[model samples]
Target chain A: MSAANPGATSPQTVHVPLGDRSYDISIGNGNLAEVGRWVTSLRKVTHVVLISDGNVAKYYQQPVEDAIAAEGIRVTSLGVPAGEQSKSVPTAQSLWEAALADRVDRKSTVVALGGGVVGDLAGFVAATMTRGLDFFQIPTSLLAQVDSSVGGKVGINLPSAKNIVGAFWQPKGVLIDTAVLKTLPRREYLSGLAEVIKYGVILDADFFAYLEANVQPMLNRDPAVLQKIIARSCELKAQVVAEDETETTGLRAILNYGHTFCHALETVSGYGEYLHGEAVSVGMLCASRLGEKLGVFDAESTQRQAKLLSALELPVATPKLSETAILSAMQRDKKVEHGKLRFIVPHAIGKVVLTPDVPSEMALAAWREGIEDESA
Target chain B: MSAANPGATSPQTVHVPLGDRSYDISIGNGNLAEVGRWVTSLRKVTHVVLISDGNVAKYYQQPVEDAIAAEGIRVTSLGVPAGEQSKSVPTAQSLWEAALADRVDRKSTVVALGGGVVGDLAGFVAATMTRGLDFFQIPTSLLAQVDSSVGGKVGINLPSAKNIVGAFWQPKGVLIDTAVLKTLPRREYLSGLAEVIKYGVILDADFFAYLEANVQPMLNRDPAVLQKIIARSCELKAQVVAEDETETTGLRAILNYGHTFCHALETVSGYGEYLHGEAVSVGMLCASRLGEKLGVFDAESTQRQAKLLSALELPVATPKLSETAILSAMQRDKKVEHGKLRFIVPHAIGKVVLTPDVPSEMALAAWREGIEDESA
Candidate 1:
């Protein structure tokens, strides 16, 4: 087992500055033990509806319940089957009823203790149950640790679309224990790196260079490297989120840089075919290539990301799906305003813009070019 | 059919002071005719997903749709069955699917044009769909016009609990037309007056006294009297809502003066046995009696409310049900914390406070007192 170095294991807190909704994201290696103290520090919680999933419960639910129970705070722990399917309406309904049955009230706090699916589902329940409850997140997966946990995006999917029904309900605090990542399977672990890379490419040039330099350490799961990447990604994402929490301003859309292509790819290829971050990996490259075609971004930067993604073992090639299907999927996104293509094409490694009205043909051409690059 | 007198017919706007969530309640005899203009005046809306129920649609959907369409705003009208049963998960799921099918998007405004049921069900949909869409309300029922339209409490019931699953989603604007109340059944209209009277007793002594003076005119549906009651009721309710929007500060609980008894009555007696306002009427009398039993309130004030409620055609008599059943039902209310009864009791007209831990026996005694008044 790769232990995060003592220095890296030291707790780091990232404060999401959302005014009244602002909360700290405590990131560390072994701070899971401090959860009870950590939560009570935020608010006077007497009852907790702790939600988790089957896979996560095997490793963590006990320590969590014990830690919270130790605080003299009553804990009602409920677990659902693990995986993407749990992010559905039925799952949400069951959780709502379960929490209510166990005596959840306006004063009760909901603590989400699992991956992105659990965070999203649990957060949605907290948002609507009793018209919002104080929510705390103990995100367990690498994908959640750096991305979903940082943002307040939580919801369930409809059969027709993923994340079709949801609310941007922020958590009171998020606790990310890096030690848990040691238990994450290889594919899921690497998929998370794609999003970690996303922050650097979209916002910070220095972070991108750091990730570029730390390939070997990152590959070996060096605790120091993992801590640095996770903390830096959260900080960058927090800055963007604080600036545009509700996405009312177009400023928040920069975070969706490649999401258009990513969503299209995920939809056209079917959801399970690509874990979200994996599609994001392939999607980012497509967005980068589209930038190159637009003449604002260079091929060197595109190649740089390609090399990094491939080194990280995330797929870089566009799948062999019909271009028409992909295009229709993009237009179908409720996020897309007026059926027009607004691509978040990166201008350089660190900058991107929400470019509007790039013809459907141009987007298609960008996809077609990626299909030709065998190594990409 | 009673039309609002021309003078009372002039639009009276009540502004709910909730910072950015603040919106005006525009009440007039015929403001429904200008719903499109009223909506556009509040926000830049291009598309409207107008939600109405079967009963409301029979009277007002087309005019509302045409008014919006005439303003060059696209309208997608949807109709649900008109009743309390429609405020359920299955109904919400169906509405979500139907709205998405009609191209509901982030920019699409959701306009709820019905009673409390449609307002809440459609509002909950707008609150969660795409993480919330701009919502407007055109409440068509007397019960909705003065009460539900002002506060942002929107949700659905779990068969186990009323409003157990919901969100505090505020509308961008709410338009209420008193003219529509002319079509409201006599029973429903009288039921709505219960809430109108509640505000006077809970917040404003002046309004309460005014209501006393205008009883005959109010019963006659004098348009001038109608305008005074509806406008004052909204303003008072808005003041309480703005002071404690999400009910976190305990100030909002004052609005629930009789809700504990009313909810338990509705739950135990089976919903629809009494319209919400009718139950509220009986519940208020019960609470006043509880107040009198506790020595803080005078019997004269209790008798005054009883007289007004009876005069207004609302039931003041407690239902013939088992005392234990009512006690258990109140304990089961999600609003009741830790099984102790927290009653919102009046010390006098125009002032109420949330009193905690009034013994279950005392509450039952209060209920028993109401049963003894033969004329109540």
Candidate 2:
């Protein structure tokens, strides 16, 4: 980790060391404007396939494209409809064809300029086009900047599954501009904070406390606080990814602390009903309660998380969805092995364990207990 | 390289040493029956997604599926039409969906069980399904056994491009049964020999001489010679791939000795106009002639290749397609850099160099000289 300046607003670099696939994530207040210099500084680029979503393209695509083009690089700006629906095979194919139509060659680089959907889809295109092209990331959304953009995991979703068809295609560089969060819708911004809190709970207790203390600044979109949390989240993730780049060792499973429950909630509730991190907020509480049920975690820790999540304005209570459906979706999750359930259950803040073969009833109870009461 | 038995009839294994990504190619007569044992010996398996083309499924798919199923492993056999046309986005998507419908999971392995088209399409399916499944190759065609199956380059084609979308996804193991070639149509079988001959031209002079001496046995598809040539070809290709796994280093370009011209001919003449290797047979001569034009190669070497290719009964004359279309196609080749024509030019039998800055006129002249004389 290195900061270009000592001040909180200055650009910071978090190096993700994965041998030959290792790269740096540059975090700053308004580094989006430095997109041109950032890309050229990493590698020579004659052509770029700049991919974004409709919502993102309006605010950021033009400036990002212009920034890169200012370096005398030809940028092919492409956009898909906003939201998760665009992260499909059809969209991936369209992007591939569009890039090809623009004469994107092996020499051309792909730069993902939107949120996770764009990052994952565009990364898949980069990974497959001409066997692969160099890729860079300019993640616009907080969720992407802190999570998807840092990891090499990129893919399109199958209709039956989310994040199912993809590859570990690492980018040459990731440029995160925290200033962009200012334009993000208030709810979406809050949804991202849930994940920011996840890093602290999973890896660093001190960082968790920092986040808890800075809720107001985070809500204010304070550049200093944003840079710190985003940088720390990326650092925590990069450490896990560097150890297990492909998740082969299961060391990476710890990052999925609440994701097993998170995915189930999102699926059973129907996607788009719960934005990912919002569901993650609800899911974390469920997992925490499950941990308490399993006797490995305490109620106080769960309450602590619930308090912080409520304060951050993210959903702390799980919605009223079918418990059976949630359980079934959890069973169908990629995490379940040999018909047995597995979850990343927390023992304490900064310490989680991958607990396997937990009884279905107990897991279901965790979800059931979190339901909000209509009478209340 | 190691042989299970010293005799030529016994299975020989060409180990592709790519560290953790390494796997072996097993070559023998009638080894297809041993497919079950071979795959299980490599890794643990519960479910297998067997992908093949319609042309091959009629003969081998049943036995292959039965063999694997006999081992108590579930086998889901999938098929596509038997031509290059099936190597497209729609075909790939259908395979993905079909595999998912059959409950394909992260633990399931994908086995490609046909020629190059099936091998490539299935391998791409394997590469992407669940972000990559363990892949095994059962190359029925000689072209696949010797070339496509050996390298990890697997992908589908876009309507506007051939193999423009793909990944370098290696198979866990490759089972090459020389007996399978017996059912191959003659023209297609001969087309495969063109690639086998290419291995000798690019890297192994002794192998080249051996191929030249064993022309009759090769043409007859003699069991021992088939195993020897296929094993030698895999060994040669594996060596190149091991040195430059992802084409990052220039070493892998040597494997594309005739492919630049081959792709151009395939394109301008329309894709189905020439089977890939038939085009290669013509392309290699053009390259040999280009080498001669540049004064780096002797005409005697060019004649030697011509004689071997002719004796192999492969096409030796370039088709009369539009020269402009051919030139433009060549320019569009992934090999061309900065608008400069480049090619793998042979300096001698078993010795080719990736020659850059090749003048367009000279490349055209090479193609022109190979044009058949209708007057005669």
Candidate 3:
């Protein structure tokens, strides 16, 4: 999976139709070069505030600032420490002050120029900076480019939980250049593949079959496969968002097929041990096992999923979390309604349902199946 | 202006019909007692995370919690230190953790029981907690009851600015009990009168006249007059909200008759020294003055506003901020567009327009009139 692969070339353009919240998710070669024109068309922006993490800022900040400035807008690039820890209230407060000091007024457009963590933090900041402002997403990581950038789920993590403080703020536009994938660590790219696999399992069985067959190519970062997967994933998410913009209906829950368990694992493991995609990889296995146990899915389905994830070199089993800890973590999941566990379990590949009440015993059984229980 | 005063005794209710975003603001005696029933009827709520600040919690927490519990719904009260300082991302993060720890699920309701600060913070948490959940308001102060509770404008403030992190999250219900106003400090009570005055000046000149003629009686805490004023203000705000739920239309801009200048002043002043209403009182004067300078408003109109504010014991002139500082602050205001200053200036009482390209000199003159040279 080398960046030199011809298919690894960047995308030309992609569209995300979310009704009034619709935005374009353009990927391809040198997409970053067109950020100024893209952002200007989306927002009546003059002053630009480019928010990036420290590491990415060191590399891409100069070019991004220059691009936006070339449009005759003053650019203030704010660099925060990169990692999960940066997505906190204190960091958001600091960014708020930095923007104030830089005089990034309401007319200024906020450009999040990093991975998922930066996108979430900066998007949340822009969403609430002045009761909301236009934000553009230049997702630098596979996870952010394919997933977070599309759904408008911007938030910061809490010490006790992940993404406990946030909002459903849509971005003005998302600029994805596969060229950035060249800079991402291998482990991070694999983690992102987990989300790509998730869209297949939850929405399109044919897509799932495509993923199963092309797992090797995807792992190798074949540009054609990668671009197709990213586009399909984003399209699926955008369709869901258009139907249920605020997540009121059941349409949006399908997008959270593995997120219920994934978020719990992310929070309990302290957020940094495993990236979001890794957690989702493990979470999907648990959800599949749960579905099988509840008679909603067959055992063959679980094996097929395990084979696909294993091929991607993604985790197919839960981590070494205790049942009680996992239960406690799951209890903190945002999906719980009236203290009853709600799981987005698959009825079949390409189809999912949000169960308001997943039987406690079945959930425990699946958790135990995926994890070793020292208690029982 | 005693509670028994003829003008302050009768109950009034204002309806904010926003389709799925609709809610009612009930102003009168025993409204608090009916909260459990009203909210219960609106949603399948079984538990409530009641959030309040120290001041209101001290006097009303136990009673409110008990009443909600009496309705057979579980209630968990979380109290924070009372003040504008509490409207921070950190405080909101803490609340999210507390809600998680208390087993607050999606079906559980969050009841905000305090003033504008508490309402804004609590409502924002509910808006994002689990990607938003049901929330109700038990506004205890004059300002919150008449203004914050009805509009569904919930959020927290950044150190650099007020209400910098928040959302336009509508509540399931807003229960305004005039009985709770009895416990508010006299200064806070007077501060609320400022917002009530804004509603009149923006939408109902007749209400403005009513306020002018009965300012003292209302400030004296006469429940009848207060009820009338609160209901009228809620009705005016509700109509605007119905017309423009997300503030995208010019209809909602009318609601910011004084807020463009008010938010700038609040942001520059650090949100500590001035109550929101106090800043708004001064801001209205600034806007009127700016209008007069631009020949949109007559000099006599500005003078009349100053005299009316003075009669109500509200600040009629801006604070001692510098012209440059105030100008910078206005640039950060949410109303600005694409690097241009936009002001919702009134041509006359009850008639406001959102003008996007106000002359810089007129704006500067307005700022100069509102500031002291040394304050810069």
Candidate 4:
């Protein structure tokens, strides 16, 4: 971990409550030089666009732009070009004309220093350059410190939809450090332990029996079990994006338990083939066999979530491709409704529900009982 | 004056309030076939995505997409390439890949129709496509039925900033018809009577002495004085956009009284040569001569708004241009701050204020006391 210890400790915060678009996420372990007294202690700063990602600004952008220019706060930074085709729309219209040619305005303050495509393209250039600004998120990676930096779902992506252009905006603060997952790469830290065993199989069953008893001290990267599983997956995705911040109260589609077969196996086996928590570990065994073909789960809870996602090495089967191209990419999912198919499923371990209109031959017989059938 | 009288009369509502993003504008003359029962009487929509342009989809997109597909909703519609270079970013990325190839999800319902560049590019494709949608506005001109259709602001534009990229979203309804200003073009209906005499110079001296006692029934477009000056300029811009909706309460920069010399005379007279209410009728006489060179207003109410914007034909002087290119285009506007020069001025004619740090030789001596100088 590219050390910059300004006296370590004090971090785990969380608070995303969103009334007046709330803030705070923090979390620690050498808190990357306390990102300028954690964003000028939430709010009044002069200027700081920041944004990063030429591979996390070649190991954390000069000590995070010299700890946000040692608080006089006039940073600018900028970087892009690192992956997922830099989340397009001409790289968010050339980062909104390069943050309006580096003079950003409306009391400038973007931050988003890299990972999850620099927190969804710097939280959509701070949710539209001038129409909005004050945003902050440090994220770094384990799939953006437990699911795209505690949710105010910012956007960009439309080569025919995927995050299909966005903005729920919310940030004001979100640091996360886990000492930059000690430079990740162990298959992207076991593909962010498949969304940390999908928040212990959808919302805590003793954090899914404490990740099946810290599977070998979470496969030996144990710094206090990675700060108690990334602060319990950012307090279970800031309590489902503070009770559905903008998923218009369908209680945030039970945090998309295995994101509709991990976004139709990351859109028909093609978007950097897995590594979205290894397609949420093969979309949590096709939503635990579509919760055992809707008899509300069990087949030994889909072999205890495929022996804890094959003991955290991940990919619990199901990628033999074309089940009519994974049901036409789960009928183009942001939880497709008007054309039907919706599913959050799981029932046993720490429960789940959002199962509406599911019968397409019972979700293709729960993706042909996770294949290996060979017409048997 | 294309008449399609679906039994006219009943419209005049206003509402805007904001709690739960409150809405309702209605106003009428022949309620464009009650725009699908005033947007399905507020919400349970099905699918709309209407948008529009190509010059208001050639005389109103098939009667507003056949009156919202004759109330069975599901419209789709699209269209672009009409003006302000189709509020760019490659026409909002080919309109988010043609509204996700006409299947725009998240409970689709955009509408927009036309004018104010098709309600700011279909209210910025109903605020960032799927991140927001439930919108509606039929505005068809009179500068978007009185100021960008009751202000939920939506955006796009950045060949170096102009609506830089946007969203304030808002619009569950706002029909306005005044029979589509009888197909406008009388110099865009006297440049929308200079923002309907700038909501009577900022907020209504009896709607600016009732537009100086209805100038020949508002130069004879008089369909009940163009529905009483577009319902009193959308009830004074929906009461300053419901007391400052996202222009962050400097009480919405007193609706930019002569918008800082009408955005520095629409940026040194180059943008479609002054039809933003004829550069707010010459930036409301250079903000009423910088409110009479800061002795807080009166050149007998700036020649009573220059004899009601020259009896409604507009362009009341000051366009001799280069006063250092209209003070470097009013210090690159979204109400310039950290570079000083903030404006809005006029303190009488129903008051106005926003002031802050002004001096650049008293706003260029209120732009050289509006030229026509001839050394006197």
Best by lDDT: 2
Residue pairs with backbone atoms closer than 3 Å in model 2 (clashes) = none
TM-score for candidate 1, please give it: 0.96
- Native contacts conserved, per model: 0.73, 0.84, 0.76, 0.71
lDDT of 1 by residue, B1-376 (tens): 2343445666788889999888888888767888888888889999899999988898999999999999999999989999988999899888888888887778888999999999999999999998899999988777898878888999998987778899999998988887788888889999999998899889998888888877888787776678778888888888888889888788988888898899889988988899999999999998999998899999999999998999898999897888889999889765577677899999889899888888999999899878855465
For each candidate, what's the DockQ? 0.82, 0.83, 0.56, 0.27
Q: Which CAPRI tier for candidate 1? A: high
**Per-residue alpha-carbon lDDT of candidate 3 for residues A98-170, written as tens digits (9 for 90 to 100):** 8878876556778999998899999988887767778899998898888887878898876766676678888
Model 2, stretches more than 4 Å misplaced?
Answer: A1-6, A374-376, B1-6, B374-376
Output the number of the DockQ-best candidate: 2
All models, RMSD in angstroms: 2.4, 2.7, 4.9, 17.0
Interface RMSD of 1: 0.6
What C-alpha lDDT do the candidate models reach, one value each?
A: 0.88, 0.89, 0.80, 0.80
| Model 3 CA deviation exceeding 4 Å by range | A1-14, A258-276, A286-301, A317-347, A353-376, B1-10, B212-220, B241-346, B352-376
Assign candidate 2 its CAPRI class. high
* True-structure RMSD for candidate 3: 4.9
Error of 2 at B30 (Å): 1.0
